[model samples]
Target: MALLEVRDLVVSYGKIRAVKGISFDVEEGQIVCLIGTNGAGKTTTLRTLSGLIRPAKGSISFDGTALTSVPAHKIVSLGMAHSPEGRRIFPRMTVEENLRLGAYSRRDKETDDDLRKVFDLFPVLAERRSQPAGTFSGGEQQMLAMGRAMMSRPRLLLLDEPSMGLSPLMMKKIMSTVADLRAGGTTILLVEQNAQAALKLADVGYVLEVGKIVLSGTGPELLTSDEVRKAYLGED
Candidate 1:
């Protein structure tokens, strides 16, 4: 069975639908990416799966447990961590404090070990552990945000637009970190506007347009497809 299964999911903001009956699954130890342009409801879909936005219809099951009715905090405790769009780190908190918050749900001594692991993953964070999160540069803040998410020791990590507001160099660093995380057995559901970067790193890819999936394929298949090349890769 898939580690994370989303079946016929629908989400709405009042009368307007944001996700119109979409379904996807992420297997254990796979990186599944959803690529779409702005306003295509990619972030909305991630939010719904993360339990930040309640679904209007359909079911979300993670590791065979029903998640559609769970509270956002409960979902995280259940081993799904969401690193939201815009990198919403607590501005006044120290880098260490911000990361500690991610482990609030856990009582195990291993949480500290996970914190050390995150620092190892992003050494800049270790260097600035005592500093306020707000003081970091954009790229550094994004790294801290990801490191904070890692503190949860999640089985499924949901990432929304990790490369937003980053320099080209910063974007490369962040995406490479994602690849490294996947290699370490993290199952990820990624939403990205950078189609080229995302597809290159994903095990499988799905394209969303107007709140529905338009295509789904393996990474190279989507990368080489004529429609994807024209619409997302900017190739003629």
Candidate 2:
């Protein structure tokens, strides 16, 4: 069974429907990416999957359990973690404090070990554990966001716009770490605006336009697609 499955998910804000009947799946250990421009509901889909926003219609299944009615904290314990858009790190909180919050759903004793793992993945965070997250650079904050999510020991990692605003060099580094996380056995469901960077690493890719998935394919196939190139990849 797929590690994460979303079917016919529909979400709205009062009168406006943001996500329209989208269905997708992420097999264990694969990078499945959702790509679209602003206002395409990419962030909304991630928010809904993470249980921050309830879907108006549809079902979300994670590792065989239905997640529609599961509360957000419960969803975290179910081994799904979301690193949301804008790298929403707490400005006043110390880096360690922010990371500790990610493990709040756990009742186990391995949080210290997992904390070490996050440090290993982001050594700079380790070096600055006592510093305020807001004092860090954008790239550093992005790393902290991902590190914080990793604190949950998630089976499936949902990353939204991991590369939203960063230097080209930092973006490359963050994207590589995403691949490494998959290599280490965490399935990833990614929503990114950097279509070229995202599709390059994705095993499967879906194109969302105006809240609907307009096309789907293997990453390379979509990379070669003329329509995708024209619309998202900055080609003719």
Candidate 3:
């Protein structure tokens, strides 16, 4: 069974439907990416999967359990962790403190080991362990967000717009880290606005347009697709 499965998912804000019956799946240990332009409901989809927003319609299942009604905090204990868009780190909290908060649902004794692993992933986080999260650069904050999510030891990782507002070098660094996480056996469902970067790092890619999935394929296939090229890849 797929580690994560979303079927006919629909969501709305008040009267406006932001997601309209989208279905997708992420197999265990695979990197599945949702790539789209702004307003395509990419963030909304991630938010829904993470239990931040209740879907107006459709079902979300993770590892054979229904998640549509699960509370956001409860979802973390189910082994799904979300690094939301905008890197919402607590401004006043120290880096280590912010990371500790991510493990709030856990009762495991290996938290220190996990912390070491996260520090290994982003060495700068270790250097700034006592610094306020808000004092870091944008890329540093993004790393902290991902690190915080990893502290949960999640079976499925949800990343939304990890490369948003980053420089070219920082973008490359973040994408590389994502690849490493997948290689290390974390199933990831990524939502990204950088279509090229997302598709390249993904094993499978879906193109979401205006809250609907218009195309789905392997990473390389979508990267070379003529329609995708014109519409998202900035090529004529």
Candidate 4:
């Protein structure tokens, strides 16, 4: 069975529908990416999976448990972590404090160990552990956001736009970190606007246009697809 599954998922905001009956699955130990332009409902989908948004129709199953009605806070306890778009770190909090907050759902005593692991993944975070999150650069903040999510020891990690506004070098660093996470056996569902970068790191790729999936393929297949090349990769 897939580690995470969404079937006929539908989400709406009042009279307007943002996601229209889309379906997909992420198997264990794989990086599944949903690539699209702005307003394609990529963020909405991640929010729905994280229980931040209620779906109007359909079901979400993670590890064989139905998550359709789970509360947002409770979802984290179930081993799903969402690193939302825009790197919404607590600006006034120290980097260590922010990472601690991500373990709110945990009752175990491994938080310190997890914190160390996060610092190892992004060594810069270790250097800035005592500093306020707002003082960090864009790439550093992004690292903190992802590290915070990692604090939960999640079985499934949902990442939304991890490379939004970083320099090309920073973008590469962020994507490399993602690959490392997957290599360490963390399942990931990534939403990204940078199709080339996302597809390069993905095991499977789905293309969403205005809330509907228009194409699905393996990473390399989508990278070479004519339609994907024209619409997302800027290849004429």
In terms of lDDT, which candidate is strongest?
4
**TM-score for predicted model 1 compared with the true structure:** 0.98
lDDT string for model 4 (1-236, tens) is: 89999999999999989999999999999999999888999999999999999999999999999999999889999999999999999999999999999999999998999999999999998998999999998888999999999999999999999998899999999999999999998999999989999999999999999999999999999999999999998999
lDDT of all predictions, in order shown? 0.91, 0.94, 0.94, 0.95
Model 4: CA > 4 A from native: none
Q: Between the candidate structures 1 and 3, which one is better when assessed by lDDT?
A: 3
For model 2, residues 130-185, the per-residue Cα lDDT tens digits are: 99999999889999999999999999999999987899999999999999999999
Q: List model 1 lDDT by residue over 1-236, tens digit each.
A: 89998999989999999889999989999999999988889989988888888999999999999999889888898999989898999999999999999999887878778989999988999998999999999888889889888899988898889999899998999999999998998899888989999999999999999889999999899999999999999999
Can you tell me which runs of candidate 3 are displaced by over 4 Å? none
Q: How many clashing pairs in candidate 4?
A: 0
lDDT at position 98, candidate 1: 99
Q: In model 3, where is the ten-residue run with the lowest total lDDT? A: 185-194
- TM-score against native, each model: 0.98, 0.98, 0.98, 0.99
Give residue 133's lDDT in candidate 2 (0 to 100). Answer: 91
Q: Which stretches of candidate 2 lie over 4 Å from their true place?
A: none
Tell me the lDDT of candidate 4. 0.95
